[model samples]
Target: MSPRKSVAEALSTRAAILERSVAIASAEGLEGLTIGRLAGELGMSKSGVLGHFGSKETLQLAVLDRAGEIFRAEVWEPARPAAPGLARLRVLCEAWISYLERGVFPGGCFFVAAAHEFDGRPGPVRDAVEARFDAWRGRLRKEAGRAVDAGELPGGTDPDQVAFELLGAVMALNHALQLHHDPRAPELARRTVQARLGRPAAVTGQVHRDPPEPTTAPER
Candidate 1:
């Protein structure tokens, strides 16, 4: 093959490997990934599979990266165009529900499974998983804060708490779908999310307080 063609083939093979890796990792946990297994399933030689990633850790990291890309495409990008603050947050939540409902990964969300599998472990893989979760929570928190600033969410609302609850709701959706196979899980999650966002948080500590009422009524 020409040098250009050889490079193209190599790229194609790498993409195929990562695609299969993400699917396998989603259903079986990242630890379930092995060069030999992937080689057999993809019809590639063991050496060929290992040649792309060099080691299992590298392969796992690559799979996490690939899964992240898919997640952004499915869950984040759809919400990107919405108005920032509550509008964007609402869109993000809706997309998140759809992502889980559609079963984007053969096993629910890839990060959810990876999070459970790697939570107790310590290493690059575990760090990668944690980092992804942190970033996701940060995004949620950021939008929630903006909503509060924009007077969309109650001033009393805690963005971090909102982020936590939102993440928890979707995580529960994953659990219900994966473990109990609950058919109402998606809609149930939607209702839970909507209710959580719709209800104003009660005043708690020093940081939370009710928004002051408008001094004068003018516009309709």
Candidate 2:
């Protein structure tokens, strides 16, 4: 077999640069993230950082994609195992708020921060960030529909509206927790989502658990 790829392999190189971009963008907004700044912070040569991304816009898009991947892993995946209905809805909301509360980045949510930065700026970066934002909105609608299908939520619920509200709630708490670094705002957001979905206020996080086995520990 061929030798293993180097640590600076193409994919690894891109990932490393994207991670650095995310950190810079999160702290100082996208404007503050430049090829030079990233290279300087990462202690890599300017040409080294440029070699991976090729251009500033490409780097921004890469950072946005990487941030979305991070969000899905930390927030979406954990909440996915929850029963696809009210239970799942609560889990998803709590997962979102808790992620922001934990301060995954110094600046708050990567998506939320990026939205404001790129929102009116015309370019690939704006398109990419907006697309990522809308993707979460769509995911929310799908989950909300599951709730209606199971009769866990009131019938005739508007998936679009519910999706919008959940997004708003997450953003509201994201703003507060990041600006003030207060625990209460995040807690309030989490509880509000639970209450809206008729879930208990325990915030157990048990909803994200694996499905139960058919039998308790196979008989010997």
Q: Residue 153's C-alpha lDDT in candidate 2?
A: 82
User: Candidate 2 lDDT, tens digit per residue, 1-102?
Assistant: 334666447677677778877788888987878888778877888998888878887777777767777777667766668766677777767777777888
Segments of candidate 1 deviating more than 4 angstroms: 199-220
Cα-based RMSD of the predictions, in order?
A: 10.3, 7.5
Instruction: Give the Å error, residue 79, model 1.
Output: 0.3
RMSD (Cα, Å) of model 1: 10.3
Distance from true location, Cα of 135 in model 1, Å:
0.3
lDDT of 2 at 151: 81
Candidate 1 residue lDDT tens string, 54-74 = 999999999998888888878
Superposed by TM-score, candidate 2 places the C-alpha of residue 112 at a distance from the truth, in angstroms, of 0.8
What C-alpha lDDT, on a 0 to 100 scale, does residue 66 get in candidate 1?
85
* Top TM-score prediction, candidate number: 1
Model 2: residues with Cα > 4 Å off, grouped in runs: 1-11, 200-220
Q: TM-score of predicted model 1?
A: 0.89
